[model samples]
Structure formats: C-alpha cells, structure tokens
Target: MANKRGNVWIAVSGVVENENGDWLVVKKKYGGLKGKWSFPAGFVNEGETLDEAIVREIHEETGIEAEVQGVIGIRSGVIQSTISDNMIIFKLKANSSKIIVQEDELFEAAFFPPNFLKDDEDASLLLQSFAEEMFEKMLYKIDGLNPGDQFGYTSYRLFL
Candidate 1:
C-alpha cells in the first residue's frame, strides 16, 4: 500500500451503536486494515455523497440499514504511504440491532461498550488516537453541544 503524498482514497464509515449501548465494530477482511477491528467503512465510489457512502458502507458491511444522525468531525491521516487527502469520517446512528456479518468484507462484527476496547482492530497508535478523538466528539455531539463552543473542557478538542 504505497502511499502518494497528495493522492489518497476517499473513504466513509459508520460509528454505529446498538441497544446495549455498545459501538458496532468490524474486522476488515482486506487492504491495509485487514484483520484489524474498525467501524464499518469503505471507499467512496464515483458518484456518491459522503452521507450516501456511509449508509451504503454500513449496509454492505453489516447487513443493516442505519440512519445518519450527525457528523462528529473529519479526521485525516497517512497510511499505506498515502496521505488520505480526501478522507471523510462520519459518525452515524443506527436503528437496527440485527447485524449480519458480510464475510467477504468483514470477518466478524460486534458491539463494544464504552471503555471496552479489548478487541480494537487498529494497531497503529495514530489511528487509536483518532478513534479516541472521535469518541470525544461523539460524546459532545450526543450531549447536544457545539463542538466549537468555548465551554471549558466540554469540547472534543479541549477534552483530549
């Protein structure tokens, strides 16, 4: 996965949670993140919006249709020698709890409760940090706070 400095794949993902209050995660089957646990995600196709991509990826990976609740924030990083110049991260909320595994793209799927990351798929510390940041952002967003609002340590950027 040799990365080009300015060229990168456009990817979308779903930060889904179930009734048990656990976040849904999957183990990627192929590519740079193969065998690692991550939120259901995929490359955005030729003609699709970020929201559409997230919905499609969610259904394709988990066999469940999810509703787009909100945008947590965008995260960009380098991997496979690529800079991910056009990457888009989306935080989604789901309505279905009956998740079916799509073996070709993901080996397994499950819900993880907060603070329980024993099966974290990402091995890179950089990605882990990004996940933590996203979670913080999610918390803020779920609590109905403006991420940019100057509310002491309540903001995602400041919390981390």
Candidate 2:
C-alpha cells in the first residue's frame, strides 16, 4: 500500500533507560519544543523500519548507542487540521551511559531519575505525563516477533 495523499507523518521516540535506573532526555535547540526536555525522537525516514528509526534517533540526538527493547506506546493525532501525525514510542536499553550531545539539534542531553521529569518545569507535558505514569504503573510493551520465512517483507515488527 502507498500513501497517495501524503498528508501523514510517521515519527519514532524512545524511552531509553540505563543500567542505573535512570532515563535519557534531551533539550531541543529549536522549534516549538526548544529548550524543553523530552525523549530522543525524530521522524522515520523513507525505507527505514520502526525499530531502526528509534535506535537511529536516540543515537542522533544524544550520541548514545541503544537497542530497542520493545514497543511501549503509540500516539496519533491531527495537527492544524491538515497533517496527521503518528508516533511510535519504544522502550530502549542504552549500550553506554556516556552522551555526546548533538549540538545542532540538542542543547543538552543527560540521564535523570524517574521522578525528575514529572516535577521539572522545563520538561514537556507529555514527558511529565509519561514519567508520572511510569512511576504509578508498569507500561505494557510489545516485544519483537520473529515471523517465519513466510512473509516476503524485509522487516516486520507488529504490535501483537
């Protein structure tokens, strides 16, 4: 299937956690989200898989190599009544704690305790909500599935 209208945008984000039980967050350097703390995220490029996009985004924004653990959540909404945006949030495990922030895209990147974002004034509302929810309940995640050699697609990660 193809999107003939081209009005939809697909994005990916990661809730990355380190071994010490801290979460990774970054402050964007531009746009409406400038200076606000949020998880590393970006638009999924052409021909890229969802898991690949989340890992690439985390590395691009925070300079931390991470592996996708599972799919955490999905959010969809229409922006400005024209563009439909769909974002898939993934749970990631950081390979290393060291972060070399991408200066052009992010102002700062660091790991913080779970309770930090929920009360931080600079954190985005969505980030705060996620943090609060994480503190209160366990997030249901969809692990990757290895389909048999039946499907001809290059990659398949269905939330089942």
Candidate 3:
C-alpha cells in the first residue's frame, strides 16, 4: 500500500537532560497548552536543517546552548482535520544549564525529575509519558535507530 502524500507541518524539539537524569521543560503561556510544561520546540523554518532548527529553538525558548548528542525520537499530533504536526526530537548535552525563558510565550523554564507525581504539580500526563518513552528509546536504540537516523522514536495523538 502506497501512502498518499499530504502536507505534514514538521517541527523539532530537544531533550536536554541534566547529569541527575532530570528533563528540561517550559510552561507555555499561550494557545492550547497554556501553563502546561513541555520541552522547548518549534517549527523547522524554511531554509533551515532540522538540527539547526532544534538547536535554535532550544536556545530561543530556554536560553540553553545544546550540543546535539543524537536524534532520539519523533512525535506527531493532529490539529483538527487538516493540520498535523510532526516533531523530530533529539537528545542533547547542555553546554551550560542556564535558562532564560521567553516570557512572551512561556512563563517558566526548568528541569523536572522523572517518576514523580506530575498531577501534584499540574504537568501534562501525556507530555511526561512522551518524555519517558523517548528516554527509553534513546537508551535501547530500538528499531536500530541511531543518532542520525532518529525517525523511529515514537508517535503520539494529543486530544488537547
């Protein structure tokens, strides 16, 4: 079966882990995800490579200069009927941990540890699960995915 070609709006995100295995995330201040914590991500701009876009997004959103460790995974969500966003996520090593959140769109940017009760802090369950799933894929390198060939990460369907 051949897949039909349609417009897939592609985006990129990064996973910058601290030495203690915590994940860096941001709280959105606009749109549907307002106040919910998520990773720093944005659309791949025209004339920019995915790598460059992810790095730029991380810096712009979190003020973190991240060295791309490897291509870790993929995340996708559909918006209504026509707009579907596919995000390519990478694993990064922070050159520095300093974060300067873009207050216009995000309220706070910080690292949150894993396996903690997210509901207590009002973090998105889906986003937390997404982080955990990507972490596991990064460790196991399942489907023979490497740093460069990172498309085999995982898929997600977000309701809101």
TM-score of each: 0.68, 0.86, 0.73
List the candidate 1 regions with Cα displacement exceeding 4 Å: 1-6, 78-85, 118-127, 130-160
lDDT of each model, Cα atoms only? 0.66, 0.83, 0.71
lDDT of 2 by residue, 72-108 (tens): 7788998778889899888888998889999999999
| Residue lDDT tens for model 1, 45-124 | 76666677888988988887787765665657765564554555565677888889998778888877645554354533
lDDT leader: 2
Which residue pairs clash in candidate 1?
3-81, 3-82, 37-121
Q: 95, model 1: CA deviation in Å? A: 1.0
Q: Predictions ranked by lDDT, top down?
A: 2, 3, 1
**TM-score of candidate 2 on Cα atoms, chains taken together:** 0.86
TM-score for predicted model 1 compared with the true structure: 0.68
TM-score, candidate 3, is 0.73
Superposed by TM-score, candidate 2 places the C-alpha of residue 71 at a distance from the truth, in angstroms, of 1.3
lDDT of 3 by residue, 47-101 (tens): 7767778889989988888876667677788766676769877787778788898
Per TM-score, the best of the predicted structures is 2
